[model samples]
Target: MRYLVHYVEDVTERVHAEAERARLVAALAAERGQLRAALLQAMTPMALLVGPEHRLELVNDAYKRVSGGRDVTGLTYREAFPELEGQPFFDIQDRVYATGEPWAATAVPVRYDRLGAGLEDAYFDLRYEPVRDAEGRVFALLSYGVDVTEQTRAHLAAERERQRLAAVLEHLPVGVTFAEAPAGRHSVSNPAAVAIWGVVPASPEVAAYSRDFVGFRPGPGAPGSPEEAARRIASHEWPLARALAQGEVVQDELVEIERPDGARRLVSLSAAPVRDADGRVDGALVTSVDVTERERLLAESEAARARVTAVLESIGDAFYAVDAEFRFTYVNRRAEALWQRCREDLIGRHYWSEFPAAVGSESYRMHHQVMSERRPVHYETISPLTDLWIDVSIYPEAGGGLACYFRDITARKTAEAAREAAVARAEGARAEAEQANRGKSEFLAVMSHELRTPLNAIGGYAELIELGIHGPVTEAQRTALARIQQSQRHLLGLIAGVLDYSRVEAGAVTYRLADVPVGEAVAEAEALVAPQLRAKGLGYAWSGAPPELHMRADREKLQQILLNLLGNAVKFTRPRDGVPGRIEVACTVDEERVHLHVRDTGVGIAPEQLERIFEPFVQADQRLTRAQEGVGLGLAISRDLARGMGGDLTAASVPGVGSTFSLTLPRA
Candidate 1:
């Protein structure tokens, strides 16, 4: 231990030297790593180092940025950029490393494929350069890329805009033109403008066309541009010329241009001053709308209006029209004549002001109603202004107004009033006559009643005498008493018939109506008249009666009517010219009514005397040669009673033939 310690010099210096050498090695390694990191990070292109197995060995900040900051270290090129797999980008990178050459592409497109990366298509200029070691063999690849999406998009958009503008100018409908200001020198014209002017601007100047080709402003006595310009200078002052000269906008100006083929066209023109970059008017832009069709339509409308005015002025009836405000718009000559004023005076004046008295009249109200309801109204009113009756027809118009057509009817009204008065007087006289007849009927009825009492008493006394109730009678006396009884019975029948007829005419008879069997009533009526028929030696036939036929009537009235018809047959059907008398009674039914027909083969009534036979006191044989005993009151009474029972009696007879009396009653 003594010999080891004797020559020990301080070894701290050697230890320091070793430690410094180790520290210098560490610092150099760290500096080299920092420089490699800085160099990779400074490149803007997506850069990464790949090993021989194609796995990512190193990644720079630019690589992370291109991958949207995803962790792609140690991933193969196919795994790192999955969207570029099977694409030229991977092949290019491979070729650069294999061939030690550089490849560049313009506008190379790529897409990022990662979760939450919002991968969209990106275009870029890409360059791939092989990175080689000192042996000049490629070990890895370097990629440089620049985004060019905005520049590419801007170029495409500008091309599309140019195409749209060309299409719009080619297909425009209206005539469009641009010309130099104040000089009328043409710059350009659409196809429509060329066609409208009938000539393209051959000299590039509107003034090259003759004055006949240019549109001119309308002047007095010219509906539009005439065959010749109003003046050469006047044509130069048209819409386009004025806009360029004055630097002002000219809109909706009407001008007429004559084509080279001698056709006139009306056009509405609009123009505006075109400014240069310095805001000074250098030219004019003009447009034209063809108005030839519109001009023709306006001309036709004017002609139609004139015709309508002529018709109104020549009409016979009064015609007038008013607006919604009750102001008069038109009045015809007839209306003016009726008003005793000129048409010009009535037109444009308020209706009430013209005819103040008509303000609240029926005509005024009707006019208002027509306008409000949008329909026609017709009425008759008397004008207080003229005290004349007017017949008015009011019609609604599309413009919220009413048109009135009327005529004076005072003459007709006066005639109608006079006729009405005459009719009223006649009605009064008829009523008085009816009352007088009713009085006469009542008197006759009373007289008939009084006479019947005495006549019946006389008949009773004569019958008693014939029966020898007072004393025994001789043969001649007995004959005389029989004659007296016959006379008394005949007088009693006359009195009864008169009373019945009077009652019928006076409307004093009453009936109890019911659905009565027609057959039964007919049988009873036939039985009542059977005795008289037998006494007159007449053949009576009743057949063809429906068993269930019913009529809505009074049973007694029906029977009475039948009896009267049968009695007449009995009286009139006595043997005439050795022909035996015959009578027929029939009952028939239809859907609406029941019919009872009584036909007699007798001395039929003459055609002239048949109508009078039913009148009271009238007889078919009124001459002395006639042998009928009773008056015609029976037939008249029977007819009236039939009517009261909802039935009518009609008679048809032919001389030397037969008479048919039909009773028609409503069927139940």
Candidate 2:
């Protein structure tokens, strides 16, 4: 029985051992299936095993795609993918395998650029885990990763797109720039931008040909120097900078910029702020267009305006402009002179302050009326001086303004008054003279009739005596009757001279004109003045061309002019020692006219009174003691007659020296 029990125990131990072996087989198979499926689901997790290490004991199809490998069976890592053997990725895997502990890392941007242009650089998130045998020894490593190459490539592509856009903007023909909004600070710039600035030409040819700008400055009142200006620019402090910083459009803000040559250029800068998606100003886009021509035109226009102002100041008459409030807006040089006010003192002040309130009252009213009615007003008023008359006019301007013009007419007014008084005196003198002339004519007529009556009776008696109607008287008695006749004729001659003078004053002098020899006329006048010359013991001398050379003239008037001048000369001459008293009459003719001169080498005219001697009712002296004994109308009448005959009479003399009087007449 004991033997039988021992055999049973041995059998039981055998059964238990066999059952444990079966359970172990089933668990191993199930775990293998799960790991294989998991590798397929998470391909990158098993990518490590099939890498260039030829460790393909476990891996997925994803490892093949990433590695770009084909079949790797029965081959070492060198044979499978020789290029990957010494790569950085392989080195990282070796470390993971040696560590035997799980590892994961991030933060460093990954790079993988083995692909071509269409398929470029990618990134990854990698992990490695240790797989342990039942005995706790690690023989393999499990790697898990994500092929983030697409994400990395997409990010890189977006960056490239932005660069391309910037490049395109910089290379554009017109200069383009971006600055900070409200603070124009220069940021990143492209090669083309640097070239346009002339600060840093990137292209080799451009750099060689152009000068680079180290920086900009405000100088005294501008921005900063070129070097520091960049900072101010980056900060956006300039006009363009401010507008840009403020996100506003800057339109044609004229700015003076000092160029490299230390010259200023007028520039018109236009700018606007560029905003980001968040609606914040990122920078300003700007363009600067030079407008020096426009600036020059503006300066010229200003100079022309100043010239006009100067011209207005130079006119002779007072001129000024006034506002509706009677404020002086503009006053010219004459205005200031006439008002005794400074231009500065009155330009902005009331016009009434320039003159006394009591004075220019009419002018003040006219100014107001013109402005109020928008019409012109004119009047004649006494000047503020109160001694002169002025004609003043005020005209309204388009916009409630006024212009005034004034001219002084004091001389004209005085002349008019003198003319009226002279007319009154002439009328009075004419009435008195007419009454005196009537009395004289009556006396002369009665006297002539009384004297001539006796002469006629005597002449009749003589004729009867001769005819024997009565016995012939003795010869002596007949001669006595003839003497009476001659006396009567002389008296009539004196009356006729008086009547001729009166006729001239009464505007009744008659003239007969004919062609007469200038020389012959003078000889006849010398004959008439012969008696006066003989009385003064002066010689009567005549000079000129022959009588055949004639002058178209009133022959009687010419004789009268010559006789009057010669008679006056004979009257003035007095007998002197060795120097003969002489009256010289001379006449000469040219192609067109004849000149007759009456000269006296006798008592000469006084120099001081030569011109006055020609005036009627005037003589060198009023005293009756003077040798001259006739009314002072001879020269005046001669001048009048000469002018009437389209000729002129003139005289020249020296005190105590002989005088020459010339009469010019037109030729026949």
lDDT of 2 by residue, 1-668 (tens): 45544442457877888888788878887887787788866756354354336375655667656544454434554555565544565666566667666777642244332332232334667777767678976666676677776776787789899899877876764456555433344454455444334333234433322221212323333444677666765664555645544667877665666553445656666677778899887777776655556678888999997997888877666788888877888888876776667889888787776666534477767776788789898888777644468777788877688887766678988898899999999999999998897776566456655666665676566566655577666778667756765654554444444444444544556666688877777768767777777776787667668757888788878887887777767767766777777777777778898888888766666777887877765676668797555556667777777777778898887666677889998888
Collision pairs in model 1:
none
Over 4 Å off in model 1, which ranges?
1-311, 373-377, 576-578
lDDT of 1 by residue, 1-668 (tens): 45554566898999999999899889978975985677577766556456444566666766666676677777887787787765677677667777778898887777765233677776778887776765877777665577676786677679889888667766787788777765656567778777776656654334655333334555333444555444535546566666877787888777777766567777777888999899888988888777777788888999999999899889889998899888899989898788888978878899888788878877768877887889897888887777889888999888887888999999999999999999999999999999999999999899999998888888888888878899998899988888888888888888888888888887779999999887788779877877887787888888866667778998877877887788878877878788778998887778898888899887778889988877878888889777777777887888788888887889999988889999999998
Best by lDDT: 1
The per-residue C-alpha lDDT of model 1 at residue 231 equals: 54
C-alpha local distance difference test of each model: 0.78, 0.66
Top TM-score hit:
1
Give Cα distance to truth, residue 331, candidate 1, Å. Answer: 1.1
Q: Kindly provide the TM-score of model 1 when superposed on the true structure, using C-alpha atoms.
A: 0.55
